[model samples]
Each structure stands twice: as structure tokens, then as C-alpha cells.
Target: MSRSAPASQGSVVLQTLAAGKLGVWPLVFTVLAAAAPLTVVGSGATTGWAVTAVTGIPVAYIAVAIALGLFAVGFVAMARRISHAGAFYTYVTRGLGRPFGVATAFMAVLAYNAMQIGLVGGFGYITAGFLDGHGITVPWWLIAGAGVVLVAVFGVSRIDLNGKVLATLLIAETVVALVLAIAQVTHPAGGTLTYTTLQPAGLLGDEAGTALAIAITGFVGIEGTAVFAEETKDPSRTVARATFIALAMICGLYAFCTWAISVATGPDQVVARATAEGPELTFNLAAPYVGAFIVTIGRLLLITSLFAAMLSFHNTAARYFYSLGREGILARWLGTTAPKSKAPRGGSLTQTGLAVIAVGCYAWFGWDPLTQMFFWLTVLGGFGVLLLMALTSTAVVAYFARLRTGDASGVTSSILTGVLAAVALGWISVQTVFDFNRLLGLAPDDPVARILPALYLAAAVAGLLWAGYLAARRPHVYRVIGDGAAAAIAPLTAVPHPAVPR
Candidate 1:
């Protein structure tokens, strides 16, 4: 296979990333580190109050984590076969085709963008809210705008360095937060865990579905291992193990914490109480168990956690763009790597610029981050992920169908699992879009909610169009799309295209 035009001696950058910069443990820690605590204060928990709500906070955590693990059963297996920079897009592209692969890449880019942008919006809110309590109120966009700059700096830096910093921050924040949560639950000043909350009489009737929905939000970044495939030393073995480890850590931590908190609040009043208090219920409850100082630390950690998440996804989002561009789908610029650092400079810059632009627009319009930006972006982002998973699973089945006929290995089982995963994910995509009423206003004004998925569709269409154009003009790049060919899997380099074309 022809490499994307031959390498230029001076213009082309060489690979700086070794096969195994990150071991299994570090990789798992990096991905799950950002998502674990985010469940507590994200839009899901905040607005869950508006829905069915949960006061016995621990119960909510327990339920949400386990449900997310269900996705892992199929996701990890796919991870084993499709280890590349494009992650799901690569899997489907090889299993499916270049055109559909481009579509998946677009979906991933949008999904990751929605997630990162939400963090930016909400991080500002948390900071401003904390300040407001101190009798000082500033605008939310200003804080968000600042965060975009910080994220860009980190996003363009070395991935290993980012991993190290994340490990330190995550370890400190989760450990302290967990200690506080455990203490509060075990020896609550308020109440004790009992059958009331566990079997909460009307749980299934009312809060069951609602709790499950909110819980899914906590596991948002579990697929993050996909993003690190290029940086991973042994992607097949490392990523496979990392995915399960991430799953276990996230689920185990959240479930136990939730169960503990349920004990503290006493299950009977959990739903009503969590609902009344809104997003503040967990933090408020912690003040007594952990002390005011600990609560303050938690608030600061929340800000950092959000920033960490934003940074993490920003990197992942850039790779989606990078993969698409390398395949000649989007612009060719995103395909370029930076020399010396060997990062996806073009893609990272694009993501950062877009995010900054979004922050600017929200600021210009004087829009509220909590109400407009956070709510819409996060929910829609979730929808994009569902679509990507569904489509990628389909691609897996397509890729493996031929092999299954002659062989009796797990190939057949893999295809079957992919088929089921695709179906489930597709249903979720439809439900999420149709159920905008839960997040948006009760009436026609809810159009904004529907727009997120619409944006995803538009982006996917654009990507497909680009892929078609590439197919017409550059057949070589187009053919490499889903085949997992050697040329398409170029090493991360920083060199510019040679002025002399092949």
C-alpha cells in the first residue's frame, strides 16, 4: 500500500511515540480517572432532581455504575480486534468500508466535542456558583473561555505527561472524596441504609428508569481506551485489559459509594430528598461527614476533575478528526502530525479552536452555561455515542460474516455479540432523541433538544460527502478507509507534506 504520498526527508516528521509509552494500569487510570466523580455533579445528577431524583445518593451511584458495565461486555471484545487511532471508527471502517468509517469518525468527533464542551460550560458554573455563595457573582462564559485555553495547552502536549498528571490528580481527588463519602454513609448524622431505599416501594414504578438513565452518564468516558490505541505499547493486550480494569474500577467505586450513601440517608426519603435538593444534595450531605474544609476541597477538585475530563476528551476528539483527515475525508490538514512532539497538532488545534469559538459565542450571546450550553451539549453528545456504537457494531458483524462461514472459532460469537450491541445502541439513540421532553421544556420549545442529534447527522453527512469526493479524486486514500491496511495506519509524525507531490 502506498503511504499517504511518500515521506519527505525534511518536511515529514518521524515517529516519536514508541509502541508502549503507557502500560496497562496507567492507561486504565488515565481514562477512568476523569469520569468517576463526574457522575456526582454532572447534568445527569443535577437535572435528575427535576426528574425522579434520589436523596439517598449512594443508591444512585450503585445503580448507575453497574448498568454502564453492561456496555463493556461487547465493547472490550471489539477493542481486541480493532486497535487503532480511530478506535470505533477504525473498527467499523475495517469491518464496513471507507465511507461508513468516515461517518463513524464524524459521529465520534461530535460526541467527544459535545462531551468536552459540556465540561467547559459546567466547570464555569461550578466555579461561579461557589463564588456566588461567597457573595461574588461573575459570568459563566468568562470562566469557560479561560478553561478552553488551558485545555488547548495540555491537549497539544505529550500524552504520557498528561497521563502522569491525571494519575496524581485523580488519585488525590477520588481517594479523599471516597473517604468522605464512606465516612458520611457509615456514620451518618442523619439516618441509616435500609430496605426502604433498597426496595424503595415505587422505585421501579417511578424512579427505576430515571435512576438508570442518570447512572449511564457516570460511565460516559469508559470508551476512552479507544483513544489511546496509538499511544498504547501493545494495543491489543493493553487496551483489552485496560478496558476491563477501567470498567471494574469505575463500577466498584461508584456502587459501593452509592450503597454507603444510601445507608446514611436511609432509603425511604432518598428519591424525594435528592429531588428537592437538586444537584447540591451529595455535596451538602458531605459537609457533615467530611467537614467544611473537605467540602471546599471537593469543590476545587470538582473544578479540576471537569478540567481533566475536558482535556482528556479534547485529545480523543482531535484523534477522530485526525483519522478522518488522514483518510482524505475531511481536510488533509488534520492528517498532519507535529515533529518533535509527534502529537496530532492539526486535529488538536482544530478541536481547541472550535471549543474556544463555542465559548465565545455563548459569551457573546450572554447565554447561561448551566441552562443552555451544558444541558443541550451533554445530552446530544450522549446521543452521538449511541449512534457510533450501534454503527460500529454493525461494521463488526459485516467484517466478520465471511470468516464465520468456514471457521467455528469465536469469530461467529463476536459477530453475534456485535449484532446485539448494535441493536441495543440503536434503540437507545432513538429513545434519547424522542425523549428530549425529559430535558427540554414540555412543549415545542424543545426543538433545541432534538437539534443535538440533528447536528450529529449533519456532521456525519459532511464527512461522508468528503469521503465520496476523496473517492472520486484520490482513489488510493479512499480505498484504505476500512481495510486496516498498513498505509492507512501511519505512525504519528509531525512532518508536513512534501511540496513535490507524488
Candidate 2:
């Protein structure tokens, strides 16, 4: 394949990514690692109080899970056909066109970068607090900077190294959470098991939007299976299998833990207790049902969980850059990979640079590490993710509907699943935008909440216009936009020209 273009030619260069370094389980661990299972349980237990306080946080988790399952149907179908690191953006390009594809790619980079950088704040704060409890005090930035260095190192190493680290942490934390949750449900804190927690009324009315929004964010990295396709053993089967397994694990774990918490506190009182105690709600209940020692382990695991998420998002953001660079949408150097390690070294360093700047900005302005840095940025990232998923869902429908005449199969290429996922994600996108203030715990007119969503709009416009310019002036490059490096070369050879000299 043609991997590069000479600088004298004034054409974009592209490169193929490393391949076949991951298996199904490793990929599953990688994607689930990004979700930060323990962190979700701890935070959701508190954030969910708004909805479960009234009545369906457990149900909300299940509902969101169902929507994601439908999304997986069409998404996996596309993955089978197009095995690339670009994920949703690639699918959008093939199904829609190059311009829309580039637009999505730009949005993805912004969103994933926001999500990855935002996580460092939470990790640092939690690490600082955990250390403070041990009679050691350090500023959160110090801990965050230390993490950046560690993650930067890991990001440039082989991906399986990350898979091993994440799996170990994931298994430890998941076990602790499950043990406590089982104990809570098996014994019942108040000696009564109430079924009211499962009713739809619990998920309806005023705060349902907020509860659902939080639940959806727990699944943010679930789509990452598509992101690592280039490295997986069997791009099609492995990606799909790993995606399904990860989604099942995420949905089952999240719902069980949330329901178990309600069981421990009794559905009626869980909201008040969770709101008052925050993450302590789970530990306090676990101390009696399990043991103080186990609760301590769970708390410790919470810190590791954030680190796992940081690593996962770091890799994810790096791959987006690598893929975009390969498509000529970014600087060619961004696509370079380490030969021996098969790591996206250039992309990894870029992501690390971005993280440093974000942390520095937060430190310089003296923002609240937990609220401003963690909560605000993560929510913005989640909002961007929802928008992207909704667009991909539409793209899937459009991509397959075109094939309905004869070539496409009934089950694999049907537009039904895509429609279902698109509608579901589209509704959530709207809910998130309209209820942006509630999600951020801000008033309706808060500048931060109101202004952040507009950034996505700006990114989309800029990306589309940039793509339009390429389409008009550099049609050869435009033709190869999301088709990968080898595919890109096909266009350069086939570019049409005038039949005769003017």
C-alpha cells in the first residue's frame, strides 16, 4: 500500500495501523475498562438519588441497556464490513459521505479528549483524598500530573499491556462490588426486600431525564469495541463478540448494583441517604453486610477504577488521531506508529500533550478539581458522544437502506435496528441538550452549561466546511476520506483528467 506522499506533491499521506494483537476477552476488558465499572456504581448510587429517590434508576439502567443493544445490532454489522480504528466516523463516511464523516471525526476527537482529560481530575482528587486518609497530603495536580506521565508511558506501549492492567483492576473491583451487592440483597438491610424499585413510576416524572442521562454516561466507552478493531484478532467476530459481552456485563453489573443499593437502604429511603452521604452510601451499607475490611478494599478499588478509565480513554483518543491522520484529515505525522510495539506513538504523544495543557489550565485558574474539571468536562464529553452515536445510528439506517433492493441480507443489513437505536439515541440527545442545566447542576442560564453545548455545533460547522473545501479542491483525497490508507491510494491512481489539453 502507498503509505506516504512526497512533500513536493502537496498531497496528504496515510498509513495502515498495526493489527492482530488482541483477542475477544482482552478487547472486552479494554472497552469495559473505559466504562470504569466501580466508579459508575459509586457515583451512580449518589447521582441516581434524584430519580430512585422518587421511584426507577434500576429500570433506567436496563432501558438504556436495551437501547444500546439495538445500537449494537447495526453497529456490529458495519464493523464486520469496515474494520478500522475510526469507528463511527468511518461508518458515517461510507454510509453518508466524506464531509459528514470528517465532521464526525472532528467531533469525536474533541469529545474523547474532553472525556480522557476530565477523568484525570477525578482520579487525582480521589487519590489525594485516599492519601490524606493515610496521613499523607499532596495537591491533586501533583497526583494528576503523575498519572499523565504513567498513562503517557502506557499509551505508547503495546495495547495488551493495558488490557492486562485493566483486567486485573476490573476483576478486583467488580468482585468487591458484587460481593457487597449480593450480601445486601440476600440479607436485606431493613429485613425486607421491596419490589417497588423496579416499577416504571420510579423512572417517570420530573427527575427521570437526569437519572437516564447519568445512566447513559455509564455506557460511554461501551462503543469502544469499534475503536480497537484494527488490533483485534478477528476484526469482525472479535469486535462483535467483545461488544456484546461488554455491554451485557455493563448492564447487568450496573443494574444489579443500583438495585442492591436500594435493597440495602430500602427504596423509599435510599435517595435521602445517598444524597446525604454521596459515595459513602454504598460503603456504609457494605460495612455491616460485608465487613469494614471489604468496604476499604472497595474504596481503594474506586481509585484504581478511575485510573483504568483514564488509560482506556487515553488509548481511545490516541486512536482517533491515528485514524484521522491516516485519512489525511490531520497532520501526516499523527498517523505514525512504533514498529516493534505497534503503538500509535505519534497519536499517543498528541493526546498526552492535550492532557497536560488541560490540567495546566485548570491549575492556573484554580478551578475546583472535582466539580469544574471532572464533572463539567465529563458531561460535555458525554453530550458529544450522544450526538455522535445518534448520527451513526442514522448513518447505519441510511447505509443499509440503500442496499435493501437486492444485495443486502434481511437480518444483517436491515434498517430496523438502526432506526430503533437512532430514535432512542436521538431522543436522549435532545433530552441532554434541553436539560443541560439539570445535568450540570446549574441554573438554566448558567454560561458554562449553555456555552459548552455550542462548541459541538461549532466543531460540526468547521469540520463540514473543511471537508467541503477538500471535496472541491482535492477530490482525490476527498474520495479516500474514511477508506483507510490502501484504499486512499486507489483514488490517486484513478483520478479523472481532461480528455485533451486545453
Candidate 3:
């Protein structure tokens, strides 16, 4: 393992990320925080019921969790073999080709940026509403701008420090959610606990696709478990354990809480309650049993949950930019790390700039922050991640087939898992596309639905064109598209394992 060398005599020097700083628990905290369980249950689930009029959200969460778990089998297998900060990009490059890898990289940037920036809008709207209830007259954008600054600060700090913050916030929010769920379940409507919403059969309806799509959004950050591989103590096992742990937590918590909501309100009235109260439905349901103090705490924790999500996604997006820049696919300067913190400074700054611009534009246009900025962008981001997962699943099978090493039975099982995951994920991606309008609460005829999904295709095409340019003009850089730090020294084919400084 060697350090990254300068690409040219006078080119910007690439710095390595801080390695061996994060362990399994830290990585798990970061992944879970990015998912933002409380916020997902409060706003996302409630919105799903109200907008999509879907009553099977609980079962939908379980189905998605199973699909993602299958996806992780091959995903983790690949991670053990190829360790890189650019998780999806590296996997796609090694398994598919450099052109597709570059395309995946661009899509990751766009998707993660959307997820991070969208959280700002959510934080603003929720924070503003919370303050308004207290007779404060602060604007949502103003609060959002402050959130952007906070995330920027944290994004450029040490990765483990960010993990600590996320862990604390995640723990608090999980407690609030558990307490609420318990209150909801114990006080079931009509003194009867119905298992209707928990059954898989509930997921068969006209709005089923929309419901599943919404559920997928709740797990948007699950794949990010591998994004921190470069910074982990043991990339081989830490990544796998953290990934499954985060997924299981997200699945169980979401399913139980959603089922409790249905039980508390009775299956017949859950949708109507969500429609009327929106995100407040959960708190309102439990306020009678738990009292106003815990409810108030839950409300405050929702704001913190949104902030945690923003910070987590900001780090994920910044690292993607850093990996791209280090590989010479983007500007070399974007690969530099802060000397003291060893954080991706250039990439963090770039992400911050994008967030500022997005928030400023939305505020200037006077768009509805909750619907247009938060819901639409986050849903679009989730769709992009879904696309990446489908492609990466195929890439897993291809990569393993090309290698043809390792235990024969294990390899065959991995290949089988990849095939199944690819098919399931591909179908879900298509379903999400068709139900895009429903996800956004838009009409079937709305052009925005078509336009939003088209952005990924455009990004992929642009990436391909750029890769072609690099292939002709800068063959050296093109040969190392997903090689991480080793890209500066030699081609990926020549490097068995690229090493980062401890």
C-alpha cells in the first residue's frame, strides 16, 4: 500500500482520508442518523398516508427491508473485496466499466446532494412551525440557512467527531420514538389490537407502488454504510456489521411504530388522522397517554433529527466528491483534505455551496418548503439511490463472475443473491418511476414527474461523454477511474489494494 502520488509535476496534490478512526458502532450511528428514524415516522410516514392514501405503509416497510437485506448480501461481499470511499462508484467501475462507474459517481453526487439539501428544507419548515407554536415569527429559510452553516461546520470536522454527535442525537430520537410507540400500542382504538396493517397482503392495492416508494425513502441512507469504509478500522467486517445492524434497526422500528399508529387510531381512521394532522398525528395520538411534556420533547427531537440527517448526508456527498476528485474524474483540488481534521475540505465546501444556492433559490421563489423543497427533492434523491442499488446489484454478479475465485459455493451463492436483488430492485425502480406523481402528490399528467426522473438519465449521459473525453485525451486518468488514492500513482489494474494514511 502506497500513498497517492502527484498526477503531474504541478498538479494539485491529493490527500488521503483519515483511516482507522471509525469502528462498527460509529459507522452504524452515522448510517442510522442519516435515515433519521423519528423524522421518517413523523413526517414521511404521515405524508405517505395523507398524500398517497396508502394504508399498508407498515407492511411496505417490511418488504423494502427484506429487499435491501438481500441487496446487502452481495453489496457486503463486494465491500470485503474492494475497499474504497467511493462505494457505488468503485463497485460499478470494477464490475461494469469506467464509463458506467463515472456515471454512477455523478448520480451519487446528485442523489446525495439532493438528500442533504432537502433535509435543510425539512429542518427549516419543522423548526419554523415549532417556533410559531411558541409565538416566534422566524422565517423557514432563515432557519434553513443556519442549518446549512451547521452542517458545513460539522462536515469539515473529524469524521469520528461527527459520528459522536450523530450517535447522541440518534439515541435521543430513538428513545422518543420508542416511548411514543409504546403509548400508542397500549391505548389501541376500541380496546382491540388489529394485525391488519402488519400482514403482507395489505401491500396489494392501487397505491401499493406509491406506498413502497415512500417506504424506500425512509431507508434512503442505508446504502451509505459503505461510504465510510475508507475511514473504518476494519473495512471487511465493520462495513457488513454496521450495514445489517442499521437496516435491522430501521426496519423493526419503522414497522412497529407504523403498526402502533394504525392500532391506536384504528385501521379505518389512520389515514384520516394523518391527513388532518400531518406529522403531528403520532404526537397527538400519544399525547393523551404520555402527556404534553414528552410530546413537546418529541417535537424538539424531530428538529434535531432533521439536522442529524442533513449532517450525515452532507458527509456522504462530500466524500463522493472527494473520491471523484482524487481519481482525477473531477477537479483535483476537490480531493484535498483539511490538515488537522483530515476531512474532505474541498468537497465539503462544494456541498455547502450547493446547499446555499438551493436554499436561496427556494426562498426567493417563495415555494412551499415542505412540499416542493423537502418532499420532492428527498423523494427524487431516494429514487436515484434506488437506481444505483439496482445497477450495483448487477455489478456484483458481473464482478464475481469475472473474478471466479474465493470459495466456489460462497461465490455461487453471492452471485445468486445478486441476481435476485437485481431483479427485485429493478422492478421496484420501475414501480417508483410510474408512481412518481403519487409520491409527490402531483397529478398523473404533471410534467414535473417525468422531468425529475429524467435527470438521472441526463447525468449518466453526461458522465459517459466525459469519460469518453478522458479516454481519448487523458488515458492515464481514465485507466484509474475508481482507483481512489492509487489513481494518481498508477492504473487500478496495477494496484491490488490502495492504501490510505493512518
lDDT of 3 by residue, 42-96 (tens): 8888877877777899999999999899999888888777745456878888888
Judge candidate 3 at residue 475 and give its lDDT.
78
Q: Which residue ranges in model 1 land beyond 4 Å of their true spot? A: 1-21, 36-44, 51-74, 82-85, 133-137, 159-161, 183-213, 229-236, 256-279, 405-408, 441-445, 482-485, 488-502
Candidate 3's C-alpha runs over 4 A off are 1-21, 157-164, 230-233, 405-409, 491-502
Task: Report the C-alpha displacement of residue 229, candidate 2, in angstroms.
Answer: 3.9
Ranking by TM-score: 3, 2, 1
Which model, 1 or 3, shows the larger lDDT? 3
**Superior by lDDT: candidate 1 or candidate 2:** 2
Q: How do all models score by TM-score?
A: 0.81, 0.87, 0.90
Deviation in angstroms for 59 in model 1? 7.4
227-339 per-residue lDDT for model 1 (tens digits):
66667766667877888777777666665655554555555554565556644666676667577887777777777787777777788788777766766666889878877
Ranking by lDDT: 3, 2, 1
Give each model's whole-structure lDDT.
0.64, 0.78, 0.85
TM-score of 2: 0.87
Off by over 4 Å in 2: 1-22, 44-55, 83-85, 158-164, 186-190, 195-197, 230-236, 268-272, 338-340, 411-413, 487-502
